[model samples]
Target chain A: MSNKVLPLLMMPEGKEGKVSRINADRGLLRRLIEMGFTENVSVKIIRSVKGSLIVGVNGCRYILSKDIAMKIMVTFW
Target chain B: MTNNSIRVALAGNPNVGKTTIFNALTGAKQHVGNWPGVTVEKKTGSKKYNGYEIQFVDLPGTYSLTAYSIDEVIARDYIVEEKPDVVVHIVDATNLERNLYLTTQLMELGARIVIALNMSDLAENRGDKIDTKKMEKFLEIPVVKTVATKGIGIDQLLDTVIKEAKKGPHHEHMIGYGDDIEEKINQMENILEGDITLSKKYPSRWLSVKLLEGDDEALKKIEGSPVLDQVKNILSTINKEEYEAVMADKRYEAIDVIVPQVASRHDEKMTASDMIDRVFTHKYFGIPIFFALMWAAFELTFTFSVPFMDILDSAFAWLAGALADNVKPDWFGSLLGDGIVGGVGFVLVFIPPIFILFLLLAILEDSGYLARAAFIMDRLMTKIGLHGRSFVPMLMGFGCNVPAIMATRTIEDKNDRLTTILVNPFMSCGARLPVYVLFAGAFFGRQAGTVIFSIYVLGIVAAILTAKLLRSTLLKGDPAPFIMELPPYRVPTAKAATIHMWQRGSMYLKKAGTVILLGAIMIWTLATFPWGVEYGSEDSYAGKLGKVLEPLVAPLGFDWRIAVALLFGFVAKEIVIGALGVLYGLGEDAEEANISDSVEADPKIFALNSLGLMVFTLLYMPCIATVGIIKKETGSWKWMLFAIAYGIILAWTAAFLIFQVGSGLGYD
Candidate 1:
């Protein structure tokens, strides 16, 4: 495990990481948590192209635009 | 059997085939109306099985019971206040972990739960094995595997629901919220116990847990309670968001403990869905593929439905002629032949194209492609300063703008919702589609399909440009965050698709039977009055009104006749073509071909005027119902009037420009 944290958009394709923090407005953060993006939740980037990432979280795939992905900070383990 | 009458609710995350199960259970016994105040649909259906009468309420599909969205608030209130006998929780089998979050919340509410593991076949096809028996044991709930599309295991699910309902109320189905939160929850529950009014209104334990999590809806419910100040003081001691996050995490922890015991997967495999996404959502190819598919749909909607439309037109025309010839009184004959038959028949002929378009859209929506469309188009939507969630409502506008305006309630941002609602009418609903097809067929001839497709494209372009303009000028702000689930693509079932298509298509028929029927008779009465003047002639009332409006539209190359049709069009877009039918003196017995010939013979309407007319039709003030809804949804007569005024001004200017520019290029 590394202490380094980066925005979810920076995570390379096919890499798995855990959400460390959500740097967004209260409304968006609440929504992110509701969608299974809680802190320490493991997320695997299934595909990343053109700034949007298709990530696998909690056994479900979610297509996140760069705007949302950028607000999510994660740590790779 | 005690002849028990049970009330059940079907609840789940969106896109989990929950609606399919509801449809299967209720069949044709469903009645859909709006929720009391909100525009969200309330669906209730009943079924009698083996001496038991079961009434099922279909709750809105929600991600969680949080107060973040209207759907969530509505669903939460329904379960808390209505207290259904049994809640059949539908979960996507392949996505158990995330779906279980809702399941955990339901458990906290002490809901008597039966889990319908929907899409089991899809999960198995993805090489994920789900042990329902193990799942049932782990969660202390009945689990029934169901393939909703194929209608498998539905009876067993219902039987389990009936059994659960018969067992009175659930007493103990709580999920542990770890030590720290459990301590706080207990404290809150103790405080809540003193407030008998609150306890009687809500399940005390659930209220306590939600209050600790700082749930707004729950807090609002207990606002006047004696324990409110105490609970607020306690909640202030801890960070509200952190508590919410922690509670959510604890729920996930419960699911994490159950997952390994009940399910296994052979690694992560690239599914056929992923393969399709690779191409369809490709960075460069995605937009082109989307437009190409839209073009194909437009072509099919126009080309394939032509023969059916012709048959209907001929049948109605023959009936009108028979009535005109056989009836005794000429005015009575004219009322049957010209007023009723002409008005209704003229609009009814457009049904095939409307039905085909809705059917194609339903297929696209059910097969999961529409979500992908939204996902891929998010960038462009954000560029226009609108949320991607606005896309679905705009798509619905293609069916009708009234519902589309109401659908904007899903948009969380106020500015985004207002802007989306204002621009929704420009999406060229099916009611407007017939005007395009009629004009394009009359003038464009061999290129009618292309002309019609281009009109749709023009509509999209206008909607986008208007949105950008509104964003820059009136509705200023960034769009809400775009987060959407790209559901797995499944083959849309014919039964489900047909049912959806029929439901939407029938709305059009219902409108025709009621509103359009009245409009036609009114127009007929006006056109045929002052008995000496020929019907729809310049001396008649409708004709005189058209003459008055003719000067306003003349610059756009339209005459009094088209101007009068435009006036009638404000009532309903579909009536534009019908109005034109009456104004052209084609009568009810004229086929589509005859109407086209009539328009073709009129020198006042040529290629340029037709183009201008189509543009005006596309951009003009939305039909009356849309205006009413805009007022209702925006809660302002000011914005509604603004929408109407701006649309009319924009339509006139754009049509004038198109006509003037095209005439200079000598298009006619």
Candidate 2:
């Protein structure tokens, strides 16, 4: 079963895999959507330092707070 | 062709990469400086394209030409007074509807307009298509699609510009208001038309509309004119303070008509931008994300730059030793090796980390994320009595306090601007990076990165707290209402980001070479005074000065040497490291020399002294450049003195408390 929400920070360590198919929660999720991160869009984790991660989603890289990353659930494909 | 040298004005909303297009149009041929009578920057450049010597004037970006803000006033004044042959209104394609709002206002300015649709790639990727032919036909001007940074469709843009400029300014095809407003505008225009000076310069209808809107500058223009009393009587009869509201309503009415016809909606699903904005600005997650992102940036600055810094440190150390060995003992040797190279090298070693930090900030800014960061912080900023707009300038302060202080022009209120300028020094500018890196490296090991990160956080906290205290007392006023435009996210170009990083990084180097060099020389003199007993010793001039000041700083756990360094740091904080290097008798090149063995052999000797020194450095007075900028910007010496006095007192008190408490807890 695919997770309901994929924490953006915990996406696999490498850049080759598909992002988990999960809905972002409200507020932050809405903000993310407004900034062009939508459902089914593939994202790649570019760099992870300590707990925080910088992810490439829809051709732009976004720095994700580590705490926000924990709530996002993803399915590895 | 000489007579055909068409003057073109490039006008646009902020952050649409209009500057990028300006750079592309006139490579290596641009002059940038402050606009006269105000601090708003004026950038002019020239390019010869298609037999036309296109002199492009980049107007300050504005949302509308309503004359409510300085930028609007400047933009409107240039369009009316300078009378450019063609005005290129660059609009971000992805956010077409909101961008077109400005284009609608531009239509009323009586200048020939051409719309440059920027960021076409983002629009195409999202499957939201713009019918440029339809847009052009509706707006009655030429439309050019451009991705400015990549040089896409630039030749076509220039071709259209030349064609449009050749036709000269448009006499017809102007956007109009409602019949009632148009009638009032005509009446006002008829009365004002006799003034040849105003008639020749400004559009009669535009002036009339501005009069209706209560434009202060426009009012001042006709204030003492013979028609002033008649205009006032007419205004009072209309039962309005000014024509501003009427004009604004008409413009919005025109926008209401134009936007819907030109802009179209696609699939009803959430746009990628909207989805991402949710999480980034979520109430619970927003502040945490901001802090986390900031922490990550600091971590990268402190950690990633270490290897490069080590390389630079070793290279400088090698250069110093080689010069010492090859050159015979003389004044030239000491001056070149110690004064110029050593002093400058101490400052230069910080370039890598600061460069990286700037690179990240440039990316964040270009990606359109910084606006969201500001949006997230607006509520908190209001509570602290600072407008949300103050955050961007303060964030820029982290790179260099000069431009950041200058950026306070964006804040409309005088008090808010002054308050922001006053607290800007507490943001721990790039000049203080060397101080943190030096001591953080010496005492904290790998954890030094975290320690440095906390110092930045502490600086921001202090700034916010200080802003609160000042607002409630000296500059008491309501924070300006938060209103900001969050530009659409785009793939930030590597070239643009690199140029930004270089521009800022080179500025840091320039400051080091000039101000920091003079500061270092002054510090060296102070350290070497009473010429033979050794520099930085208790008998030396700097030491004696510090000794005289020590009693005041005693509570702050600072000795004479630390006090002296703090004093010199007021000239430039980067000089504190050079001052300490000289005082410790650890040659300028000793940053690379591992003094670990000497310190480890005598644990009681304590590198914690250096830690105390770092704390003091972190919290000291604004640097010389910052002080000068504050004086110029605030136009008052009293605030400048207040900044220095309060900063020094706060730094001493914080350092003293940290040292006393830490020592009392036996950590030292």
Candidate 3:
């Protein structure tokens, strides 16, 4: 277990990361996991906007806002 | 084959070709209605295959059976209560990892499961191979390959469904939630085993798991139960969120093990969809690109349909004229010509532009770009106290407000749904597009498109402002967080797009025949009565009615005829044009004539007055059908009446300001 986890929103565009943890409300966390943000899943930042990020996780494209992205902690590859 | 019947439910995530499979199964035998209590759409179809009646229900697309949203609740409750004979879980083969998450929940519910490996061709095209046999062995469910769009393997899917329906419910597919949580669930199930009533109503094991997960809807259901206190006492001892997370993780762990064994994936390559998303959803380029595309859609909608509109206009005019000249009795001629032909013909003439607008919209929707439009617009929509999902409904309002209001059902947050519904009518629908074209054509002449476009922009601005006002006042809440999947763009098929276009367009034509036709005839009857005086003269019923309301609208520079048309527009916005045709004695052929000339002949309708009228039309009450749905959706007359009253005040104030300011600036 690496201690190098950071919020996914802070990861630079085009960088790949593995989801390590999620710090969000129960409902949002459940939604995020069902959307394939589960722990140990590989996620790549396809695009990052000012307050949102488009991430590719498990062959699906999701547009997640800053608040949602910040809650998803990941370790950069 | 015996005369046996099978009830099957289709469940899947959005964009997983569930609808296509439903269409493939049922073909033309499908019907859509609301779920028993909620407004979420319920689609059901029946087919006779092999001498058996197979009824299919398309459950709302949801990621999980958790009751986080209304759609999820409906899907969950239907499966739990209705107890469908078999639930065919449709999984997108290309995106198996995410789609299978829903499958885990369906399995937990103890449903008789048959997995339809939809879009297998797409997976193969992307250079991935899915071994259905290994997958079936792992999940203990029958797997059937299906390409629903092309109808390949559909018969095999149905045959599998029939076979699966005969097998009783199975609960062997449960994901192990480790030891501590599993212990608690067993304890809760043991306690529930004492209560005969609760066990009969629900799967006791599933209930205990959900109870440990702190599902609010599940907790609420056990309120009056004798075992509720014991259930709560047990639930209070466990940490809910941690257990829920562990449960979710275990499900994913199961999928993680199963996915690799069943399918081998090549390292994901950047595909064309990624390239398109790179530019289309680029932070700096997205907004401008979205607006540019919308502008092109509007331009195409208007310009492409002009010649067709002219053809319709002339054809209807000829019909009216031929009837009026050839009819035996003069009164019958007027009734047939002016009353029916003039009223209904005026409403029908605008069908071309409205139909084209819907066609273009259907293409955008089916091509999957509409979701991206919502994504891009989300940033701006949030400023006005809404999220991306609200934008879809507002965009649909451009077609017609009825379906748009219904579209708000997709917005999970109640306040968001209400605000979206309240502001939807402000998004200048195609019905109102003709009114703008008529006025802008009559007044602004050479710059008609620009004027019409400006009116549309103003509608958007009004909707935004109304949303802002609603958020700050009655429906007070911060904008809900926006999270949505952007499906890869697919080349929209002409057949699917045409079916969608005609499906929506037919609603407009239906409104023309029912609501609009009745309104037109009613207005014609009002204008033609007291049967002796010159038709449409001030002494006629409609004329007198307009004159009585004239003082109320005079401050906005509207004349009696304009006032009367606005009144009739309450029925349906298209009726505004039709009412104007009737009011000025221009007959059914008003659109074919230079309607601009007759409007210009009226001393009261100048450039400024027409501008005022357009602004007024943009903000005023939604049509009768829209108001009815608003009442029905909100389930409250208070909100419905409030919507109507506020729209009137808003319309008057906006129009008055424009007319007054324009006059002071010497524009008129």
Candidate 4:
């Protein structure tokens, strides 16, 4: 079934998402992928604070602001 | 390149304990300098193991070897161009999946790799088992378990490096890019081979793959190639972004296959680091906790450093007096007592504070609180249009601006880094602290701590306003995107903290010996000249020159002597105290007279003027060392000049307000 896909920032805390699309320029896109944000990688939103996110992807946690989080589109189950 | 001397390059992602491993292997035997034509620090150290002298080159930590950032370009360039005998890819064992991404790129670079499964103990402690043997077998590389902080597996790591060097350069288990991308890579490899020099310098397949993926640095490598026209045709036909995506996917696919077989976490419970982060980054308490910790850090740094500084001052005073008694000429006695010993002593006193500050910074950093601090503080930073990465460097600026400016290299954007550098000196470095400590102690008495704390607060306020002003004007642009890895917090060990502290703190010592020494002598010569004139009297060159500059600073309540002291302070802020000591006639009374007492005894000085002086010194041009580094890092005299001019203008205006307003309010 086709599930809802939303910006990573909009995902509920504790929900895991499959990173479907990354809306960033070339440099940032490459950085995203390098950090294991490639397509279909499972990204877990561990916490949301102050319009930023604490995300766990591939066993590593990263803190990112809403600006970057918004650029990342992820699929919810 | 020497017989029985192996050259090994250390590569890894940031926060992977790579530096700890390097420090363990090298152990104070390292030298840090910039990579040629780039400001990124290149650290090299040699260690003797197994009758082989192995030289280790510590590369900038990078997640990938792409040309998106200067760090990546520098790391990749060194690996491909230098062609080291062996490359030690230090993988954080607990985060193997995230780290092995770099491994795939290293493999593509065609370097003989030995994996240092670093922090294996941490992984095991977390209930994650990393099978080194299985990891090695699958990746076709030797994997050594290392807990670098404890000095574990260091010899094994060196042995593995030696063994790998002897076996020669070979990259096995290259990721297959599937049919479509592999065809493009093969096509470019054929084209690249025509340029023998290019093919010889870079792995043809790697270069070809990079070119197909639209790597900027890789594209520049084929600038004047014979196959340029044909390569352009092929690049035009391919979707570079898609190729980039697919190739990256393939690399991850390759890693996904191996990491699972080798390592798996047994427990799904929230990690201790996670629990700490939850508390540390909590909505209401996060910011207050951050401020409290910072307050504690500064409190501990200043409290512990003061007594050590006093003891050092007396020790130097005794040495200067002993040397003066033995020296030949009367002027020479003054030189030994006041010029050399006094100047170096003043500068050296700042070192305890610098060391203590960096020690605290290291504890914060190694515990991973710095990254969280950056995270928690990012919104406030971004409000001023400063990047999140700017927070670390600015915090470091409180220790010393020279290394703090150097720390701005992490800001991937050039303009943002430049902005960080320009506003950094306003952070009131350790060298500036001595000035405030002296003035505030003499003026505010029991309230001296509050006064000193206020100066720091004012400097931070100045920095924020300057950054806000900058982002709207000359550096006009959005701040770089804010995303940072928040590494797991670990209990900081004393040894690791000390190593981290000395890594940057020693810059203070070097300045004390070199730049500040020369400055001290220059100030001495200026004050001593015009024969028969009293040392630092009105008839001397320093006094005459200070008189010429007096009008400019008169509005801020500074006299000629204070003017001259500030002029010398431009060499390094620590010299402000030394210059004042000489001008106060403490030159002759080395052991008997105290500089702070001299200030307290002055007829023209009091609390308001002292506060004004502190404000002025806080915002003035960066020290000579910091100026040189700013120029080097920005690679622009234009920006350096702008920073110098902006600081002076800002200093004068701010101090003018403090002086005029404090007097207006009848504070004095």
Task: Please list the C-alpha lDDT of all candidates, in the order they appear.
Answer: 0.83, 0.72, 0.82, 0.82
Give lDDT tens digits, candidate 3, residues B316-429.
Answer: 666766665678686677666666666677668778877887888888887789888777877787777887678888888888888789878767678988999999989888
Residues B245-339, candidate 2, lDDT per residue (tens digit)?
A: 44444544554566557656543334566568668867578889988888888788888888887777666556654554457664345445555
Candidate 1 per-residue lDDT over residues B349-456, each given as its tens digit? 889999999999889888888777776777788789886667778878888888888878777778988999988988989888888777787778778878887887
DockQ of 1: 0.57
How far does residue B44 in candidate 3 sit from its true spot (Å)?
A: 2.2
Better of 1 and 3 by TM-score: 1
User: Candidate 1, which segments miss by more than 4 Å at Cα?
Assistant: A1-4, B1-3, B195-197, B224-239, B585-601
- Put down candidate 4 lDDT per residue, B364-416, tens digits, no spaces: 88888878877777778888887566878888888778778888877787778
Ranking by DockQ: 3, 4, 1, 2
Ranking by lDDT: 1, 4, 3, 2
| Candidate 2 docking DockQ | 0.03
**Local error of candidate 4 at residue B293 (angstroms):** 2.3
Winner on DockQ between 3 and 4 is: 3
Q: Report how large a share of the reference interface contacts model 1 reproduces.
A: 0.55
Q: Model 4: which docking level applies?
A: medium
